[model samples]
Structures are given as C-alpha cells and as structure tokens.
Target: MADRITLTGLRVFGRHGVFEHEKRDGQEFIVDITAFLDLTPAATSDDLTKTLHYGELAELAAGIVAGEPYDLIESVAGKIADEVFAKDARLTEIEVTVHKPSAPIPLTFDDVAVTVHRVR
Candidate 1:
C-alpha cells in the first residue's frame, strides 16, 4: 500500500451556500482531506522534507477558502480539490469533505457536508 496522510476537521469560515444570507454572512465549514502518495522515501529517511506537510496544506486551503467566496459548497469543494493538486503533485488521489455546520435550514440538523474525490 502507498503512504496515506489525512487532514481532518480543518475548520474555516467562508461564504458558501445556496441561501442569500449564507453568501453574505458566511458560515463555519470543515474540511477533511485524505491524500495518497509515495511514502517509501519518507519512511526510510524519516525526514520531514520527504513527506507531505498537511499543516501547510491545510493553511493554504484555509487561505483559499477565505479568499475565494463561492456561492455553493460544491464550488468550494471543487476549488479545494484543485488547490490540493496544485500544492502537491505527488498526491495520486485526494478525498475532500466540506461541512457546513451552520446551514440555514428550516429543520433541525447537525450539519450539511459534501465529499469529493479527485485523482491525479
């Protein structure tokens, strides 16, 4: 199996939703990205440089989400997928989950989340 690194529960505040208020006021969003890449070198070398830095990636993602205000979560998820690929070319595949904890819905619910997978 290849090396797998997962960044979980990365929280960010962004304007992403179908509602008008959601786009204007924004909401809390959670991002979870699972990356699959080669780990043989990092395993043997035990060097930080040899492995993917998820912290950096998460920060970059946050910046992007904060910068790019998309109307829908789907666009946000797609941007994240594109951003991850731009950050690390070695990432063979990535699974991205975007969660809207404060969705403006009439019914009571915990949150609304969307997950997407992209292969490079």
Candidate 2:
C-alpha cells in the first residue's frame, strides 16, 4: 500500500529481560508502529471507519508491551506485529520497533532497539 499510519514514542512499563533483576524491577519500553494500507477509501469518504483507528492500535501495542515478559525485545516487536495484523485486516504491512533505553549493558549507550516488518 502507498499510504501509511505511524505511531511513535509510545512508552510502556514491563519486566522483559534475561536477568532476574530485570524481571523483578520492570523498565520502560518505547514502541513505534507503522501500518501500511490504502488510504483512498477513508480519504474519499471522509469517514473514520474506513481507516485504522490509531488510538486502538496504540492500546493494542501498549497492552503487549506491558503484559508479557520476554528475554528479548526482538520477541516483543514480533508479538506487536502479530497482534496488529490480527486486529486489522485492512493493513497490508506493518513495521514494529521496540526500544530498550535502560537496557542492562555494561557500556554506555544511547539506546537499544529491534525492528520487525511483517506483510499480510
């Protein structure tokens, strides 16, 4: 699809890490989702029903990020993509990015993230 809807900087708290401390003390996770679909229908009709409701999409992704504890953010990204695809059939493709800013790395880094792309 040529048209897309994107949501960025969605922050959620979750206990998702390999270390025990990480599981015990949850951290924040940032998520970004890009949903690709034909926007012609919605644009032409000027109706919300013809397009994906971004608020609902954000809620769906936020639930996943806050609900599960995964060893990897890669898994988190994949789960978001899977759930997003399941929630909306109109989307032709989706890109999910999970950011771990407070990752337990020994070295100083600005951020750690994983991105996944899925096509329907």
Candidate 3:
C-alpha cells in the first residue's frame, strides 16, 4: 500500500491570470498537494527525517506560485508538480491542485481549478 501524505487548501497570493488587470492585481490561490511516500519508517522510528514535513512542502509550493506568473492555471499546476518532483526524488507520485480565485468569466462563479499529477 502507498502511504500518502497530503497538504490541502494552502493559500497564497500569485500573479497568474489571463488578463493584464488580473495579473497586475493578483489574487488568492488555493493549492492542494498529495505525495505518495512510505511512512512506515517514520511511524516506527518516530523521526521527522523519515517522513515528509507538510509545512516545508507548503512553503515550497507557495514560493513557486508567488514566483512564477503563468497565464494559465494548467501551467501553474504543471510547474508545481515539476517543482515537487525536483525537490523529492523519493516521492513515487505527486498531485497538485490550483484554484484561481479571480478567473475571468461572464457569469458569477466561485473559482476555477486545475489539477496535475506526475510520477517518477
């Protein structure tokens, strides 16, 4: 069985949007991350090194979101997945979900989201 660790609803201010106004002002984004890792060693030994530190992952993800200005959420999510893979080679798989709060649309809606998964 795959012991998965998850970080959800990580909020950050990022400049990712289709329009200039949207990009200039920026908006709040929510990110959800899932990492497939074996936690047996950590559970048995009770060592932080044996398991993933979700807070560190969250900070890393936030740095990516705030650092890159992609026009599409798909691109953002893809980059996030790539970043995660680059950081942790041990992760069997990684999933990223990005929520765009200020998406341009005709009708009223909550937000739009994009999810991407990568495996090593």
Candidate 4:
C-alpha cells in the first residue's frame, strides 16, 4: 500500500442543497481528504517536489466546496477526488469526505457525511 497524506476537518460555507432555503441561506461544510502516494521519493530525496503539497490540496478542496453548489455531498466528494487526480499525477488513490452538520433534518443527529474514493 502507498503512504497517505490526509487533511481533516476543513470547514467552509456553501449554498448547496435540494431545499430552497438551504440554497439561499447557505450552511457550513466540512471536508477531509486522504491522498495516497509513494512517499519513498520524498523521504529519500528530502525534496518538497517529490510529494503533493497538502496546503495547496486543502485550498483546492476548500475552493471546490465553497465555490459551487451541488445537491448531494456525494457529488462534492467525487469532484474533490477528480481535482486531486488533476493536480497530482503521483497520487495513486484518494479518499474524500464531505460533512454536512447543518443539514435541514428535523430529527437530531451528530452529523452527516459522504465519502468517495478514487484510484489512478
């Protein structure tokens, strides 16, 4: 298995939902990304170029989450995975998790999330 670079609990605000109020008012969204790649090159060479820059990855994921609107968190997670593939050719796999805490559910809950995995 490849080594992993994981970024967790990135919070952002977006207007994404099936309901009109949710779309208009917006809500907070949390994102987590686990990117799999060979860390041997970076570890051996001690160079930043040998691996993906996690800060940039987080910014990209945050931009995707805060920029556009999607009815489903699954779609959000998939798009994030696609972005990771587009940006990093070295990554072998990626796991994206989108969390919605302010979802308009009438009942009580801790949180709601969707996770998507992609491999290259």
Candidate 5:
C-alpha cells in the first residue's frame, strides 16, 4: 500500500540508558511512527473500523517506552515494532523511530535516534 499514517514527536519520560543515573533520573523520549496500509476500505466505507486507529498505536508506543528500562533504543524500537504487528494484522509495513535528545554522550549533538522498519 502507498498510503501512510504518520505520527511524530510523541514525548514520553523513560528510564532507558546504559548508565545508572540515566535509568534513575530518566529522560524524555520522542517517538515517530509510520504505518502503511490500504486506505481504500476506510475511504469507501467512511468507517474507522476499516483502518488502524492511531490513538491506540500512540498509547502502545508510550506504554512500552514508559514501562521497561532498556539499555538500548534499538530494543525499544524493536518492541514498538512487535506491538504494532500484534495490534493490527492489516498493517503491511511499519517504521518506528525513537529519539533521545538527552543522551549521556559527552559531546554535544542535536539528537540521537534509532529507526526500525518492519514488513509483514
């Protein structure tokens, strides 16, 4: 499917990092999701039941980010992908991006992010 549904810059506080202070203090995490599906059903039927609900997807991402403490953003993104696949069977493809603005890096940078793309 060429149609895409995208959610960007979703902020959630999470204790996910390699350092102890990072896990204890916690930091903000930004998530972006792009899900691919056939929009024809929703377009023709004019019913939300025919399409993926974005609000539920956001909650799933937030729940994962706020629930567990992972040492890597890769793991976080992977979990998000797993949730997306589990939540809806109609989704043909999904891309999840986890952004860490307050990483424990000594050097200055704009942001650090991990993006995972999955296809069913």
Candidate 6:
C-alpha cells in the first residue's frame, strides 16, 4: 500500500548485546517503525478505529524493546516487525529499525542500527 503510518525515534532501555556487561548494565535503544496499509477507509470516515492507533504501536514497540534481551540489534528489529505485524492485520507491510548508539566498538561512530522489513 502507498499509504503508511510512521513512528520514529522511539527510545527505550534494553539489555541487548553480545557482552555480559551489556546485559547487566543495559542501554538505550531507538526504534523507528513504518506500517503500510490503505488509509482510505480511515481518511474518509475520520474514524480512529479504521486506522492504526500510533500510541498503541509505540507502547507495543517499547514493551518489546524493554522486555527481551537479545544478542543483536538485528534480532531486535526483527522482533519489532514480527510483533507489529501480529498486532495489526490491516497492515500490508512493516519496516522496523533498531538503533544502538552505545554499542561496544573500538572505533568512533555516530550510531549503529539494524532494519528489518516484513510483508504480510
């Protein structure tokens, strides 16, 4: 679908990394979600029920990011996509991006992120 709902820069704390300290200390993760679906029904009717509730979407993503401990940001991205797809049947597709800014690396970098795209 051409119509889409996008939620960006969702920050949540997560204990996800390869190292032990990462799991123990935890860190912040930023998530971005784009859900593609037909918006004609909601737009014409002006009904909230006909469209995806972004607040609920944000909560869903936040819970996922804060709930699970993963070894990779890629896994986090995938999980977010899976959960979003499961939560909304109206969605034709979804793209999820998980950002890990405090990743343990020797080199200097602005950010590290992984994106996962899923089609229903």
- Best-fitting candidate, measured by lDDT? 5
TM-score of 5: 0.98
Model 5 segments more than 4 A misplaced: none
Q: lDDT per model, in order?
A: 0.83, 0.94, 0.88, 0.91, 0.95, 0.94
- Best-to-worst order by TM-score is 5, 6, 2, 4, 3, 1
TM-score for each prediction?
Answer: 0.91, 0.97, 0.94, 0.96, 0.98, 0.97
Clash totals for all candidate models: 0, 0, 0, 0, 0, 0
Error of 4 at 7 (Å): 0.2
- Residues 1-120 of candidate 1 have per-residue lDDT tens digits of 357999889988888767777778887899888888998889999998888887888987798677767777888888888888887888899888888888777899998888888987
Comparing 1 with 4 on lDDT, the higher-scoring candidate is 4
Cα distance off (Å), candidate 3, residue 46: 0.6
**Which should have the higher lDDT, number 4 or number 5?**
5
Query: What range of 10 consecutive residues in model 5 has the weakest lDDT sum?
Result: 81-90
Ranking by lDDT: 5, 2, 6, 4, 3, 1
Error (Å) of candidate 3 at residue 59 is: 0.5
lDDT of 1: 0.83
Q: Which residue pairs clash within candidate 2? A: none
RMSD of each: 1.3, 0.8, 1.1, 0.8, 0.7, 0.7
Q: What does candidate 5 score in Cα RMSD to the true structure? A: 0.7
Candidate 5, residue 113: Cα displacement in angstroms equals 0.3
Q: What lDDT does model 5 reach?
A: 0.95
Per-residue CA lDDT of model 5 for 1-120, tens digit only, reads 799899999999999999999899999999999999999999999999998899998999999999989999999999999889988999999999999999988999999999999999
Candidate 2 per-residue lDDT over residues 74-113, each given as its tens digit: 9999999998899889999999999999999999999999
